[model samples]
Target: MLKHPKNAVMVLARCFSDLDRRLLLLILIPPLSLIVFFSLSSLSPVRSFILGRTILHPQQAVMLNSTDSQQSDVVFAPSSWKDELDRSRIAVCLVGGARRFELTGPSIVEKILLEYPNSDLFLNSPMDSNAFKFSLLNSAPRLAAVRIFRPKPMPESELQLRVLTAHNSPNGIQGLLQYFNLVEGCLTLIQQYQKQNNFTYDWIVRTRVDGYWNAPLDPKFFVPGKYLVPPGTNYGGLNDRLGIGDLNTSTVALSRLSLLPQLDAAGFHQLNSEASFKAQLTTRKVTPVLKRLPFCIVTDRKYDFPPVRFGVPVAAISSPGPLSGVKCRPCKPVCQGPCVGDVMEGLNKGWGWTDWANGTLELCNAHGDFDEGWEKMFDKVAGKKLSSERKRVWKLTVEKCIANFNKMRNRTGIWDTPPVDEICKTGITSGPK
Candidate 1:
């Protein structure tokens, strides 16, 4: 039974030879395959593709650990933010009269409307000569609602009289009430739309029709959990000209008429629009975030020419700004550089004064009506397309105005205004026969 050692070893090797080969293949193949894979992944394009897929696809999110996810969330690129906004539902509530819609409307359409084409527009304005110009909104991507009601004088309640001031308000306390009604009425319209559709908006942008935007509304301004408004022109309160917030915060901000009782109860007396706005937000515990927005309230109201210190310095429409809702119009800039510093130094910081640092402020001689040849100035600044709109409005006929209004009315989800004929003809015909 015992064989020679060499012969015995040879027999054993023959028996195990097939098992050795299989073990060798299994152990070597995996490491070899991994080496090849890493070698290919070392190429720039391949590496980038792998990383990009990992970042872009949430299904692959498991590849990143908790630390990596935290880091990635902290560093958001602009494109990512834009993508988020593109997916979000936004309501752009435009209130106030369409006094200079020719100048401001095109800008709103191009900047806000076109920039976020998915957003819905809610327009609540009073019927006036300028009302016809709102038909420009037909170009909007989504027209949610339109209410261009004729102003029957609102009976000023004793509470409104107690809570508001007439100082600097042209129509006095009644004017403030009317303006408040217009703003709050827009909110009511928005609420109704939400209820009917059975969906809620993610963001609400409340801005004036008279505000002329020079640049698109930035996505960065839409801060979560806090309401955003322009700084300066506080005038014993916050700037009420432009606001952006979520539905909860905007509900607090836009409840102008409903909040009067609360304001009165809180002993807030003789508050201007801005002051009242600040009170409402503060009392309701809404956090306000101020950022310089790239627009100005286009106004025909004249200020002192070559304004002295403490005087309102109307900015030229062409001034480089995030003007923060300062009063502006088309005119040649008369004051700039050191002149701006000197003029602003004399102005009260809490009043209508805006941030004029870094030569951002430019003055206009607003002593009289928009100076002759101002159209040329405005054209140069607003560019050809907007200028053409201005010209169209100037030459708008009774028939065309009616046609445009009718088109907009048909498109609007909610239309509450005078008959298209009455709105068109009242402004078109000159005489009080």
Candidate 2:
């Protein structure tokens, strides 16, 4: 009459099995549980990497993390420039040879002062027998500071040897090293000046002392986020010829040698000046914008105008310029007619060479012997008002320099650990800007 023992046992086991199944679900889905718990525990590391990358490269990462519960408050945006007429606090650092400074210095100074009177001037030229006298630059709109140092040549070192050897001793490689040394020294000088004065620069304008300015340095070319270099002379790449940038940009661009390793790895071994420049810009992801500047390197070397032979002069200062600054002069071209036409035809791509066929500029040559008429012509072109202004500025700069020179006595800001040899001295006396 009592139910079979087996049936009673089976009924009890079924009820237990149902209870166990409910308890298992309450404990959590194993896979999902592991995910939530670990994510919460390791929250800090994941958040940090995401935030760091965001700060470094914000442009690429924006919409990807929208749904994440963690919020990124930082926003990265590109800079915008309205090209206002207001003066820019620019610093022109001239630290190279002085041979052509006299011919070109006045024009450059006058143009900048007239166009952007708010700019400041700084010259870091090391002492050389022929360095441009500061008297020329004295007329700058606002005198910031000038320190003329006797550049200590690159110390003989392994790096110098390696750099000299690296690119098969390519043409202009030595010149490259010389330029690198000059720039690096001046950058050091800039840092020192900033520390001493407790001031920083918004932009640094670098050019040879002898670069003649034929017209206004149009500020419209200053793009917000990219470095600008003159066009035309883009020899195999970016012309390392002249450069302008803010402090943030310059810190990376100034040291040419520091970039050699990367350049070599990128297979950029035999680049000419222009090509080297292009590689440097593109490789480092430094965006470069080409713009026409109303200036050209005052050169003294002479070559055939419509060069047919390798040594023939294909490109010249004259060519009806306003050549969109690729590398032609806007001045009355010395080589008119056939030479201009030939060079124009020979030009390659958006690179080297320019066309003056439209005729808005004139002829001038840095390499040609100076004519007395040329000086008078410049004086006339500059007008009486600018001449007087330049003269006055020159006087003030000379006086300031003399005052500074006397304050520092014989040191004259030229630091020589053991002191400069008397025989090697260029004897730059301060009385000018």
What are the TM-scores, per candidate, against the unseen true structure? 0.82, 0.62
TM-score of 2: 0.62
Q: Where in model 2 is the C-alpha error above 4 Å?
A: 1-89, 141-145, 151-172, 309-320, 323-334, 337-339, 347-351, 360-368, 385-433
Q: Which candidate number has the best TM-score?
A: 1
Q: Model 2 over residues 254-364: C-alpha lDDT tens digits?
A: 756677677777766555555655676778777765656666665555544444423223223443344444333223446555545555556454445543555543334
Give lDDT tens digits, candidate 1, residues 1-433: 4379988888889879978999999999999999977765555346556556323232122112211113342223456666777788999999988788889999999999899989999999988877778877878888999998878888988998999999878789888989999999999999999999999999999999999999999776777778888888888799999999989999999999999999999999999999999999988999887778899999998889777645667899999987989999999898899998878877776685677889788989899899789889999999999999888877878899888888887877888888888877876674211
The local distance difference test score of model 2 is 0.54
TM-score, prediction 1: 0.82
Cα displacement (angstroms), candidate 1, residue 115, comes to 0.6
